[model samples]
Target: MARQTSFIKLEGTIGDVTFYKGANGSFARQKGGVSRDKILNSPAFQRTRENLAEFARAAAAAQLLKGAFREITLRAKDLRTHNRLYAMAMSIIKSDLVSDRGMRQFNLGDMSLIEGFQFNINAGWNTTVYARYTIQNGASDITADFEDFVPAVKVSRPTGATHFRFFFSAAAINAEANTVESTYVASPEVEITSQVTSGFSFSIPKLVIPDTTQVYAMGIEYLQEVNGNLYDLNNKVHNSSKIFLVEQV
Candidate 1:
């Protein structure tokens, strides 16, 4: 590989070299490597083929998860959420002890591995909200419980933020079937300076689906109230959300 310093910034193939623009700048490399046919049919590249298959499985599973949480993650996620989830998905798929290496699947792996994952790295749930809370799954609903919660003291208020709210979302994802059932619920907005009444809680119906993985998320959103409307503070840069629990049943 060599850097292209000529006046003509070229892309595409030029004789034996292929030139292209990358993040670091334009560069050229010789177009000589293993052929696609050889990699697919050769005995020596069997491991490579297995790795590609597993990679595809992980990528697909990651896409499914992203879709499952798309509502809360629309503004609460970081730029690298896809890559981060992809890496975790690969780890989860690799943990499938019952399946063969190349044939590993999400249904056979531990979905709990993704529990406690933060969608936004900048503002984490634990760091933004100091109040102690417990999440419990009931027969019909999932509940997030908080006792003696004080917003001014327990919550980390960002600049120009006037009010905040707590949100809960759950999804029942069936990886094998490629389907999802989900719901979202939120607590009433409270002023940042006011005290949240003791024994505050938020609940959403439990989605019990056969042969599905249930994932729950809890998040805090900050808002600034104008003359008559509420707007997101800091363009959602300080919004914090996390995966509170994951259960495969």
Candidate 2:
């Protein structure tokens, strides 16, 4: 018999798996283990990190946009409320002055003597008059009216007078009696004793008129006196009075 020769296969093991040599005498296992540095620099790892970063940035931008939209919505609502309030006030003032029956008409221009009425201060007795209105859904609107009262007015007399007296009148019995004095008196009634040297004038405070049912035509009365307390007279002087009307929307 001729000499017989056989080749034994070599095996390699890694992680519980065995690799054997092939018919060509090449190892079935890979030549070398993967390096840590090469894995860290691989395109797959780099792409994954970049994807995570993009996600984070998108989330932050969404949050910022949401916050900005919320702020703008709130500001727009505030502006709308402010504009509505102003319109209501103006409308009430411009409305035709009529009696309960709507027969008689009182012109606003004739009633308001003082021009350019506005709010003076924020609070207290010296504060300017401001009207406020509130509305409820499916309900009647309510209005709160306000005005500054000038109690006494000063008038210059053309001549030197010793005594001065003032009287006011209204078309209808709309004038209310003085609450403190309980006397039937119109607005801006005054009596002065001092004489006029250069120019006679009476200081009067602004009149604050409350909403009343009797007011048809508002008027003012003026009276003057000279020399001693012997002469006495009463006169009705019709002057324009200003009333502010405010409505709630």
Candidate 3:
């Protein structure tokens, strides 16, 4: 591998060398590796084949988890959310002791590893929301409760921000079935300088399935009021969301 310093940037393949632009810049590397067919069938590449198979499974699990929380993630997520989720999924899948190296799956692994995961690292949930809260998972409903919360001192608002909203989401995920049933309930916009907020509760519906895993999340976003309308901040970096709980059944 080598960096490309030529006057005209080169991309694509030139004989055995391939050039491309990566996150760090443009570079060139030799396109010479074991053939796909050889790696799949050869005895020496058994380890490689096993690793590839396990990585594919991890990717699928990551996609399922990401899709389950799409509603909240779509509003607030970092640039590397997918990659981060994939890495986390790999860690969880590796904990499966029953499955072989190439056949590790998410269902048999520890599902609690995803708890406390933040969607946006720029604005973490703990740093953004200072007020304490509790969540209780019921048979058919998920509830979030907050004590006497003074937003002026408890909440951290971005510059020129006047209002904020909260999101409570619950999801039922089945990895083997590749299915997700999820829903969310959001709180009304409140001014940053509002008085004590008590008796605040969000009753979000939960999807109860026979063999599914349950996940819950809470999100907070800062907004600015313009002439009676609410607008998101410049880059949405101030928004934060987190997976508060995970129940594997």
Candidate 4:
């Protein structure tokens, strides 16, 4: 028999066993070493194994994203847009994680999930004040391109407004507190409107992060003009979300 101190501690439940954090700043798995061969052969362990497999899949899927999005401020508590970046990343993982034959895997050289439309675009006076944007990123930079034709925007585009700011920051990996708190580097934003939509096509260049950072997070803040005033329209949680967009430098 092994002493409890001899093994690492675990914090949560996985499969039928529970894990905890030890006093020495290390992790330890609790007693009860159910053999894998026994689990595979026992009909009674069917549901148990199935659940274990499901968690295994979620864990692997999380790994594919965690490091990539440590700095993004994600606040959707229910794992939806309500939760912001975290929800978005998990949704992407859930969409891309596929189980075939007996194994699960992602489908790509890199998980390049690009989304555009509705939520990315906010409209006042219903949802057609005319706004459209694409938040795209890859192994290099992130680009936020959009057009606004809400009349007032034609003459009043404020660069200082966090209204359309894009951010990148460090990640929190330990399941502890978010390291970003409220810090992130803003992406470069240049007014490309031929005036504002009805003008012409425009392109906002890619965003870049500092060379010293690795694990990253990303987020955007949105604002709309009403009565000569700008108000927030973003659905971010806590403030940011996890990001998989890596800076290639």
Judging by TM-score against the true structure, name the best candidate: 1
Question: 194-248, model 4: which lDDT tens digit per residue?
Answer: 5444432322234333322234444444454557666654444223333443332
Top candidate (lDDT): 1
Task: Evaluate residue 153 in candidate 4 and report its C-alpha lDDT on the 0 to 100 scale.
Answer: 49
Whole-model Cα lDDT of every candidate shown, in order: 0.87, 0.28, 0.86, 0.40
Cα deviation of 239 in candidate 3 (Å)?
Answer: 0.9
Task: Using TM-score as the measure, name the better of candidate 1 and candidate 2.
Answer: 1
Sort order, lDDT high to low = 1, 3, 4, 2
Q: Candidate 2, 24: how far from true, in Å?
A: 99
| lDDT per residue as tens, model 2, 1-249 | 111133654466666445565555535444465565755578756654554443443343233322322322221222232333233223322343543222222222122321222111111111211212221212221122113222232332223322333221111111122121111223233343242222212222222234422111111223445553423233211112221322111
TM-score of 4: 0.36
> What's model 2's overall lDDT?
0.28
State the TM-score for model 1: 0.87
lDDT of 1 at 240: 88
Per-prediction TM-score to the true structure, in the order listed: 0.87, 0.19, 0.85, 0.36
User: In candidate 4, how many clashes are counted?
Assistant: 22
Model 1: how large is the Cα RMSD against the reference? 3.9
Candidate 3 local lDDT, residue 99: 94
